[model samples]
Target: MPCELCNAFENEKSRIIYSDAHVFVVPILHPIKDGHVMIIPIRHAENMKDLTAEEARAFMTAANLAMDAVKKEYGVTPMFLVNGWEYRSQPHLHAHVLPSKTNLRGLYAASEGVVGKIEASVEELTITADRIRVHFSYES
Candidate 1:
């Protein structure tokens, strides 16, 4: 099955926070808070469990770096998570990074008609990716 994330990843409008030969980080479309990021392998995998050891390491490293960048920008570490359903979502592997000081509830709420909420949709993701891109100016 085609994964929605794969389509999102290809969306140039999506916020691409960071990208290297092996991995890329983008903002979450439905962010829990202001600085929600997602990390994925440039070479898609079905799920985290299926990632090769090297791929796993690379993804984690990118996630950590993204987290640091979010902290630097937002003054909060934001919550982080990863989810995969073997039979659903194409089993693609991805990690979620959210920046918030209060409860994580802020991260999962719907974006409609909300104030001070950050949604990681294509447009918003692009803006956020640009913000994070500024911090990681030192490229590979």
Candidate 2:
């Protein structure tokens, strides 16, 4: 079976906000905050080490663009995070960009001991995606 993120890249249900040839940005199905988004490469790669130079460049560009969109749409600078291999929920490489006023340590502590998924409804995802999309300068 394909990785879930790979499936999401192809699935309309993913609520994609922005996408280019190399990467795509989508609202997290289980967001830490209102504007949390994930920057994922089109090609499957376990981590940064696995990414080719082109892929790395694309990922960084996508991350920066997504962060800018989040900031413009939410009026808050997003926190960029990447879980280490041991903590990752999926094997695919993805960067989390979350709009939060809290510091990293506070965010990490709050996330700890949290059980069960806080899945977002399709409606909520759609609305959030639309909001971020409005601020995205790229055509997708």
Candidate 3:
């Protein structure tokens, strides 16, 4: 299927509260609260490190605009979350915004959202680091 986020932007999905060429702010498909929404890059960035400068700016703009609206309408602080790299769901970069009453707790179960550590011994770390070292060069 075409990516849901891209489809949303192209088709101008009803859930969208704000949009620009590079970003869209829309409610989560399954919201934890009435005002929960996501600020997403329209261009389908799976990770923030992959976002272009234009998309980054647009993401920030959409986030501010959407969060301000959410806070105003809901009359509360808002919680924000971003997942990245292997810990993230792929093919879309999205920031979740949910209204917070006292910022006491999150709406979702901790197990559902928590990312567990990938424990490695020093031997394993050294092996991984050796493989990754080729991507960089030291200053002369």
Candidate 4:
């Protein structure tokens, strides 16, 4: 099976809120909080260290844009998270952008179905994506 990120890119799904040449931002399906998103490199790199300088720059730019969008839409400062290759479910390089004060423990439990996480429905995802997209200004 293709990587989920790759599939999202290929399908041009509603989950994608922003994209430039090097990176794209998508609302996380199982969000740690409302307005949680992810910045994913266009290329399939397993780790940040694997990214080229240009790719790194693009990722940072996109991440910043995502933070700004989340802040504007959700009225909260955003926190970014990265997992090393060993901890990643997908080998593709991506960084998470979440609202500050998000309960990380809740997010973990939600992922495992031990507790309910805010899983955006398709319509809700589309609205959230549009909310962020309108605030995203960095396009190259």
Residues forming the 10-long window of minimal summed lDDT in candidate 2: 102-111
lDDT of each: 0.69, 0.81, 0.60, 0.79
TM-score preference between candidates 1 and 3, better one: 1
Judging by TM-score against the true structure, name the best candidate.
Answer: 2
Expressed as tens digits, the lDDT of each residue in 43-123 for candidate 3 is 777777899887887777767766666676667877787753464544667887778873322434333555642233344
Q: Which of the two candidates, 2 or 4, achieves a greater lDDT against the reference?
A: 2
* Per-residue accuracy of model 1 over 24-86 as CA lDDT, tens digit each: 887766665667677887776766778778888788888888888888877876667786334
* Superior by TM-score: candidate 1 or candidate 4: 4
**Model 2 RMSD in angstroms:** 3.6
**What ranking of all candidate models by TM-score puts the best one first?**
2, 4, 1, 3
| lDDT computed for candidate 3 | 0.60
Clashes of each: 11, 0, 0, 0
Scored by lDDT, the top model is 2
TM-score of 3: 0.64
Tens digit of lDDT per residue, candidate 4, span 99-134? 896555454554674544556678767787888888
For model 1, where is the 10-residue window of minimal lDDT?
Answer: 83-92
Better of 1 and 2 by TM-score: 2
Off by over 4 Å in 4: 84-87, 102-119
Q: Clashing residue pairs in candidate 3, if any?
A: none
Q: What stretches of model 3 exceed 4 Å from their correct place?
A: 84-90, 102-140
The residue-level lDDT of candidate 4 at 33 comes to 68
